[model samples]
Target chain A: DTAVSQTPKYLVTQMGNDKSIKCEQNLGHDTMYWYKQDSKKFLKIMFSYNNKELIINETVPNRFSPKSPDKAHLNLHINSLELGDSAVYFCAIGWGNTIYFGEGSWLTVV
Target chain B: GESVGLHLPTLSVQEGDNSIINCAYSNSASDYFIWYKQESGKGPQFIIDIRSNMDKRQGQRVTVLLNKTVKHLSLQIAATQPGDSAVYFCAALRAGNNRKLIWGLGTSLAVNP
Candidate 1:
C-alpha cells in the first residue's frame, strides 16, 4: 500500500492557467506539508496543516492555496500560474518526529 | 532563520567504498536531525535520524553522526553500491514548538561501478 500519494505525476499548462494537485496520506498522520523543489533542487516549505488546521504558512504568494478536507487529504490549488511556478511539488507527512514524501508532481508552465 | 547547508555539492565514489556526506546547520536550538536520500524522479526517502541527546545512530548499512558543538552532521554509507547513487539532504528541526524542518541544499552522490 502506498503510504503517501499525489496525483498528476506530470502536468504541463500554459501561463495564466489554474490547476490543482491532489494528495492523500494513509499513514493517519495529523500533520501534512506541501513543499516546492526548484530546478536547483532547493526544497522550500509552502504550507502545512495539522488536523485540518492551518499551522505553517510560509512566504508563498496568495496565488497558491492549500486546502485540507480532512486529516487524510491535503490539496494544493494554484491560480494564474506563471513560468516561475514550474517545479516539483511534494506532499509530505510529519509524524513521530519523522517525515515522508510523495512521489512528487512535476509542473511545467509554458 | 535557521539554514542547513552541505559542504560539497557533489561527491563521486567507487563501488564498495564507504562514503561520507557532511552537512552544517546554523541553528543551535535544533534538537533533531534527519538524513534523506532522493533518487531521480522520486521523493526524498528517510535514511536515518539522530536526536540532539545522542551523538550517533546506525541503521542497516547507514550511520548518522551528529556533532552538537560544531553543529555539523554526517551520514556514512558502508560499501556503497550503484543503487546508492542519489542526492542526500540534511534537515534540522528546531527545539521549540514548530513543525518546520530546515533542509539543506543537498549533496549529489555518484557511485561508480
Candidate 2:
C-alpha cells in the first residue's frame, strides 16, 4: 500500500484561479510536510504540521495556505495562483530520522 | 542565508562504473544529513543518511560520506545501472525544534550503457 498519497496528480489552471491539493498518510506519523520542487529540482519546505499543529512556515506568500484536519491529513490551498506557482508539490511524513514522500502533484498555472 | 548546494549540476557515468555526487552545506550546526534520489514524475526517495558523528555509512550499493570540518557530503554509487539514472539531492537537518530540512540543488545522474 502507498504510505503517503496525494490527490490530483496533475493540475493545470489559468492565472488567478484557486485550487486545493489534498494529502493523506497511512504511516501513522506524527509530523507531515508540504514541499515545493521548482524547475531546477530544488526542493523547498513550504509548511509542516506536527500532529495537526503548524510548526514550520517558510517565506511563502499568503496566497498559499496549508490546513491539516488531523495528523493523517494535510492539504494545501492556493489562492489566485500565478505563473510562479507552477511546480511539483510533495507531501511527506516523517518519523524519527526518516521521511516518506508521496508521488507528488504537478501544478501548472498558465 | 544557510543552504545546501551541489558542486556539479550533472554527472554522467557508464553502466557498471562508480559514480560520485558531491554536496556542500553552509550550516555547521546541522547534525543529521540524508541523501535522496528522485526519478521523473516522482518524489524524492531516501537513499542513505549519515550523522555528524559518523564520517561514512554504506548501504546496499550506495555510500554516504560526511566531512564535518568542511561541511561537505558525498554519495557514491557502485556498479551504477541504467535504472539508477535520476536526480540526487542532499539535505541537512539541524538539531532544534524546527524539523524542517534544508535541501540542496539536486545533481542529475545519467547512467549510460
Candidate 3:
C-alpha cells in the first residue's frame, strides 16, 4: 500500500492557468505537508496541516493555497501559475520524528 | 533566514567504499536532525536521524552524527553500492517550531563500480 500518494504525477500548463494537486496519506499521521523541490534539488516547505488545522505557512505567495479536507488528505491549489511555479511538489506525512514522502508531482508552467 | 546547507554539492565514491555527507545549519535552536535519500524521479526517503541529546545514531548501513556545539551534522554510509547513488539531504527541526523540517540543498552521491 502506498503510504502517501499524490495525483497527477506530471502537470504541464500555461501561465495564468489554475490547477490543483491532490494528496492522500494512509499512514494515519496527524501532520501533512506540502514541499516544493526546485531544479537545484532544494526542498522547501510550503505548508503544513496537523489534524486539519493550519500550522506552518511559509512565505509562499497568496496564489498558492493549501487545503486539507481531513487529516488524511491535503491538496494544493495554485492560481495564476507563473514560470517560477514550475517545480516538483511532494506530499509528506510526519509521525513523531520521521516523515514519509510520496512520489512527487512535477509541475511546469510555461 | 536560518537554513540547513551542505558543504559539497556532489561526491563520487567507489562501490565498496564508505561515503560521508556533511551539512551545516545556522539555527542553533534546532534539536532534531534527519537525513534523507532521494533517487531520480522520486521523493526523499528517510535514512537516519539524530537528536541534539545524542551525537550519533546508526541504521542498517547508515549512520547520522550531530554536533550541536558547531551546529553540524553528517551522514555516513558503509559499503556504498550502485543502488546507493542518490541525492542526500539533511534536515533540522527547531525545538518549538511544531516540527517543521528545515532542509539542506542536497548532496548528489555518485557511486561508481
Candidate 4:
C-alpha cells in the first residue's frame, strides 16, 4: 500500500479550464503540503496544512486554492488554469524533520 | 523571502567514489533541514536530516552536515553507485512552523559507471 497517493497522475487540459488534484496520505501525519516542480526541476512549496489549518503559504497565484477535508487529505483546485501551470504537482507528508512524497501528478495545459 | 540554494545545478561523479552535494540557506531561523533524492517521473525520497542544534548526522550510506555559521548544508554519500544518480534537494523548516519546508531548486547527480 502506498503511504501517500494522488489521483489523476496525468492531467491534460486547455488554458482557462478549471482543474483539481487530490492527494491522500495514510501515514497518519499531522501535516500535509503541496509542492510544484517546474521544468527546471525547481521544487517550490505552494501551501502547507497542519491539522487542517494553513501553516505556510508562499507567493502563489490567486487562481490556486487548496482545501483539506481532514488531516489525511489535501486537494488543490486551480481556476482559469494557464500554460504556466504546466508542471508536476506533488503531495507530501511531514513527520518530524522527515517528509514523504507521493508519486506526483503531471499537469499539462495545452 | 529567504531560500535554500545549491552551489551547482548538476554533479557528475564516478561510481564507487564519494559524492558530496552542497546547499546554502539564507534563513538562520530555520530549525531543521533535510536532503531528498528525486528520480525521473517520481517524487522526492527522504535521505537524511539535521537539526539546528546538531552539526552532523549520519545514516547508512548518507551523511548530512549543517553549518549554521554560513547557513550551509551538505550531503555526503559513501561509495556512490549508479543507482544513486538522481536530483538531490535540500529543504529547511521554519523555526516555528513544523509542516512548512522551504525547498531548493535541486542538483542533478550523475553517477558515471
Those runs of model 1 whose alpha carbons end farther than 4 Å from true positions after fitting are B95-97
Model 3: interface root-mean-square deviation in Å: 1.7
Model 3: per-residue Cα lDDT over A10-105, one tens digit each:
999999999999999987888899999999998888998888998999999999999998889999999999999999999998877767799999
What DockQ does every candidate get?
0.70, 0.72, 0.71, 0.70
Model 1 quality (TM-score): 0.98
Backbone clashes in model 1, listed as residue pairs: none
Worst 10 residues of 1 chain A by lDDT: A92-101
True contacts kept of 3: 0.74
**TM, every model:** 0.98, 0.97, 0.96, 0.93
Candidate 2: which stretches are off by over 4 Å? B95-97
- For lDDT, candidate 2 versus 3, the one ahead is 2
Q: What DockQ results for candidate 3?
A: 0.71
- The iRMS of the candidates, in order, is 1.5, 1.5, 1.7, 1.8
In model 4, the Cα lDDT at residue B89 comes to: 93
Per-residue lDDT tens digits for candidate 1, residues B1-113, read: 78999999999999999999999999887778999999999999988889888999999899999998898899999999999999999999753324778999999999999
Q: Which has the greatest lDDT?
A: 1
- Per-residue lDDT of model 2, residues A9-108, tens digit only: 9999999999999999997888899999999888889998888999999999999999999889999999999999999999998867766689999999
Task: Tell me how much of the true interface, by contacts, candidate 2 captures.
Answer: 0.69
Any residue pairs clashing in model 4, and if so which?
none
**Shift in Å, residue B9, candidate 2:** 0.7
Q: Is candidate 2 or candidate 4 better by TM-score?
A: 2
